[model samples]
Structures are given as structure tokens and as C-alpha cells.
Target: MAILLAPMEGLLDFVLRDILTRVGGVDRCVSEFIRVSNTLLPDQVFIRVVPELLNGGRTFAGVPVAAQLLGSDPVCLAENAARLAALGPHGIDLNFGCPAKTVNRHGGGAALLDEPELLLAIVAAVRRAVPKTMPVSAKMRLGVHDDSRALECALALEGGGASELVVHARTRADAYRPPAYWERIADIRAVVNIPVVANGEIWNVQDALRCREESGCDSLMLGRGMVTNPGLALAIRAAMAGPDASPAPWGNVRPDSSLTTSPALYPIINWQVLLPFIAEFWRLVCARLDRRKQAGRLKQWLNFLRHHHPEAERAYMALRTLSEPAAIGQWLALQ
Candidate 1:
């Protein structure tokens, strides 16, 4: 079973990808979506979004990274995908699942689900542009407002030569509400011949088992869950494997444990144990981002980390007011 890191735009950039994959159990990662519009994007754009492309499309930990493109225009997507492929990305992924209002307003993301024909045309065009041996994939929600055309969207993407499909298991209208309809993914899997990866609301090993059973898919793509609990991927990987497989050291979890953690009872990871992760993130951001932007990136990570550790919230509060990256770095060190 493959476990992929979802391409969360403005988050999950190469620095986070490096950290997560180093924690172990991530097989592939899709880079944050590169927006394609009327013009073909420059090589630097791809490099900026997916520096893994420069490292042979693999993180330092050796996990492959796929270049994801988001756009409504088929030709532009194809052009960009071709250029990205030239840089040796491990694969190409078409993004039709972004729920941001700004993106959908531009005829990209989930909005394309309304026009299955156009979506398929864009996928087919990119598929044709990339090397025949390279893998091309697509990620989509159930539908725009409802799941009426969900199967059609899945089939259209598959027919357009998508080697695999990742379904987020919600309609555009449902946008992140509770109770992802994983069963819908099973219905889509029943008809499509390519690998179907189930995504959305998988928070633990039990959740993974239930999602797999309900969606009838072995592969999965994890997003927020990975951030909330950085060790989730490793924990789930251990659970799914035979007893002989190595045990995950970070989180000691078993099937009998609750499937999800309430915020009140969320495990408060010790500040000391988490310090290294925070430090590494700060270091990497310092290397990749401008000095002015580093503090914002640190805040972004703390925003996600706070969900698991309340101390992170306290740290965020301390650093939130700090503007200088060096000051933030010093603050993290003092912790």
C-alpha cells in the first residue's frame, strides 16, 4: 500500500516534505500545486515549488515527489507539465480538488469538476505532453455541490490516462465538514481500473483501516492528519504491516485506542521532544525563504503543531509578535 503526502498549497512545501519523509513511512509526496494560467510557468517556478525536482525528484530521505499542476486551460497545463517533466519530477499530478475560493474563482481546482469534459481534456493534454513512461495522476473531490457526477469525474480522469486517482471523499460544497464519505470512494474504485487512493479525515490507524475497508482502496494520501500528528504515517504503516515489520517508536498506538483524539485530550507532546522538529523547521525555512518571510513560515507550522501540543500555542503566542527571523530562531532556541 502506498502512503502519499497530499499537496497542500501554501503549506507542505519542500522543507515540510523533507521533515515528514525523514520521520519515515511516506512513500511519495505531491508538491504544492503550481498554478498554470494562460502562460507556461518558468523553470524557476517549478524549482521554487518543488526543489526536489533538482534532487532527482526525491527528498533527501529518498522519497519521490510528484509535480502537481492546477489550471483550467489544457494547453497551458500541458506546456507546464512538459517543462516540469524535463526537470525530472518523479511524476505529474493534476489538481482538481483545491477548495480555496480564490482558486475556484479562477476556473481551477474543484470548479473544474463541474466540467468533466474540460477536466479530462486538461488531464489528457498533460498526459500526452509528459514522457509516456512517466506516471500522471489526478486528485479530485466527489463533485461541485453534490456527488451526482462523482463517478463521471473519476472515469473521465482515468480515461484521460491518469495512472492513478486520489479522491478526497467530499463534494466541493461540503468543504471540510465532518464525516467524509469514504464509501463513495469504493463506488468509484469499483468502476476504475487504475489505483484509487482514498483521502480525507484519516487521523489514525483505525481510521486508516476503516477508510480502506469502506473505500476498498489500499493506497491513501494524508494531509492535515500528518501535520496534527507528525508520527501518524509511521504509526499507520506499522499497524498495516505484519508483526515482523519494525515497530513505530514515536507514538505507541494499538487498534483498541480511540480512532480520533479530542482537542481536550490530545496528547501534549513534551516541549523538549518537539524542540528538534521545531528547530529543524526553523533552520530549513531560514535556508529557503527570505528573511522577512521566515517568521510567517514558522507561525504557519506552529498553527498546525498547536493542535497536538498546547505548548505550541504558547510558543506561537510568544513568537507571533516577533518580526525578525533571528529573534524567532533565538526564541525557539531558548525553549
Candidate 2:
């Protein structure tokens, strides 16, 4: 069974992938969707979104990372996939699951699910363009406005030569609402010959188990759940190890003073362990972004963190007023 980290746009960047993968238990990481329109994007664009491509398409911990592309044009997506494959990504993933208004307005993402033929055409074109050795995968919601043709879309992707399929388990109209309908993944799995990965509403080990049981799928793709708890992957790994296994004791682990590699192996720690990471993230992000932009990213991360960690709310409260990354770092240091 594989555990994949979802390519959440505007979040989950290279730095986050590096940090999360280093903690262990992720089989592969999918980069945030690279928006491809009518033209083929430049090499630098793909690299900027998936720097691991330059490092044999693997994170520092040696977990493979696939490059994901989002678009509606079959020829353009195929052209971009070929370009990305030439650069040697571990795999290629097509995105038909994004529900962002702007993306839908432009006929990209979940909008394509409304027209299964176009989705199949886009995937088939890209599959033909890339080397057979490279795995071509597709991600989709249950359907566009409903699940009426959910089975049809999954079959289309499979027929189009997608090596694997990832179902987010919600229709385009559902859009990140309550009740992810993980069981719906079984519907896709029932008809498809390829491996079906279940995604959505999996927040912890118990949720992972339930998702596996309900979806009847061994593999899973995690998105917002990962943002809520960085140690979630390791926890799920432990749970899968044996019936007697349990989550790691984070409180017992020593402080990661270097703020780089942890002294322990795949250590699972409490939310408090995230302090050094928060500081390091601010430092690294600040080096690459302006003050306001860095602050925005910090707030965005904290916003997700608040869902799982109480301390994150206090941190967000204190740091929300500060727009400077240095100030955020200093606040973390004081904490």
C-alpha cells in the first residue's frame, strides 16, 4: 500500500515536501499542479514547481515526487507532459479535480470532468506523448455537477492509458464540503483495472483505517489532513505495521536543535515539535519572498495548523499582526 502526498496548489511547496518527507512514511509526493494553458511551459516553470526533478525526482529522503499538470487542452497538456518527462520527473499526473473558480472559469481542472470525452482525450494525448516507462496518472472528483457519470470518467481515464487513478471522492459541486464520500472510490475501483487511490477527509490513523475499509483501497492520497498534522504519515505507517503498533511519542523525543535533520529516526512528535520547522520555514521562505508574501504564506500554514494544533491558533493570533518574516521568526524563537 502506498501513501501519496497530494499536490495542493498554493501550499505544499518544495520546502514543505522536503520537511515532511524527511520525517518518513510517504511513498511519493505529487507537486502542486502546474497550470498549462495553450502553450508549453518552460523548463524553468516546471523546475520552479518541482525542484526535485533536478534531483532525480526524489526528495532528500529518497521518496519519488511526480510532476502534476492542470489544463483543458489535449495537445497543450500532451506537449507540456512531454517537456516535463524529458526533464526526468518520477511520473506525470493530470489534474481534473481542482474546484477553484478561476480554474473552472478557464476550462481547466474539475471543469473537464463535465466532458468525459475531453478528459479522456487530454489524458490519452499526454499518455501517448510520454515514454512508456513513465507512469501517467490522473486525479478527479466524483464528477462535475454530480456523480451521474462518475464511473464513465474513471473508465475514460483508464481507457486513455492512465497508469493509476486517484479519486478525491466528491463531485465538483460538493467542493470540499462535509462528508467526503470515500465509499464512492469503490465505485471507481470496481470498474477500473488500474490501481485506485482513495483521497479526502482522512485526518488521522483511525480515519485512514476507515477510509481504507470504506473505499476498499490500500493506497491513499492525503491533502489537508497532512497540513493539520505533519506526523500523520508516520502515524499511519505505524498503524499499518501491526495491530499492536501505535503512534510515536513526540514528547519523549529531544528537541531538533539543528532545525534540520532530527536525531531520531522517523520520530513522531507532538505539535510542539513544529516550532523549529515553523522558524526554519520562515527563514527559507523569507529568503525567496518579500515581507508581505512571506507573512501571507505563514498565516496560510498556521490557518491549517489551527485545525489540529491549539498552539497554532495562539501563534496565528500573535503573528497575524506581523508582516515581516524576521518578526515571525523572532516570535517563534521566543515561543
* Number of the top-ranking candidate, with TM-score as the measure: 2
lDDT of each residue in 1-335, candidate 1, tens digit only: 88899988778889988887765567899999999989978899999899998888998778899999999999889998999899999999999999889999999899999998997898899999999989999999999999999999999999899999999999888998978999999999989999999999998778999999999999999999887777677667666664665433345322112212211122323556557767887888899888878889889888888887788899989998999877887887887
Q: Estimate TM-scores for all models.
A: 0.90, 0.91
Question: lDDT of all predictions, in order shown?
Answer: 0.85, 0.85
- Report each candidate's C-alpha RMSD, comma-separated, in the order given: 5.6, 3.1
Clashing pairs in model 1, backbone N/Cα/C closer than 3 A: none
Model 2 ranges with Cα > 4 A deviation: 243-268
Runs off by more than 4 Å, candidate 1: 242-271
Query: How would you encode candidate 2's per-residue C-alpha lDDT over 255-305 as one tens digit per residue?
Result: 222212222234454666777677767776778665667889889889998
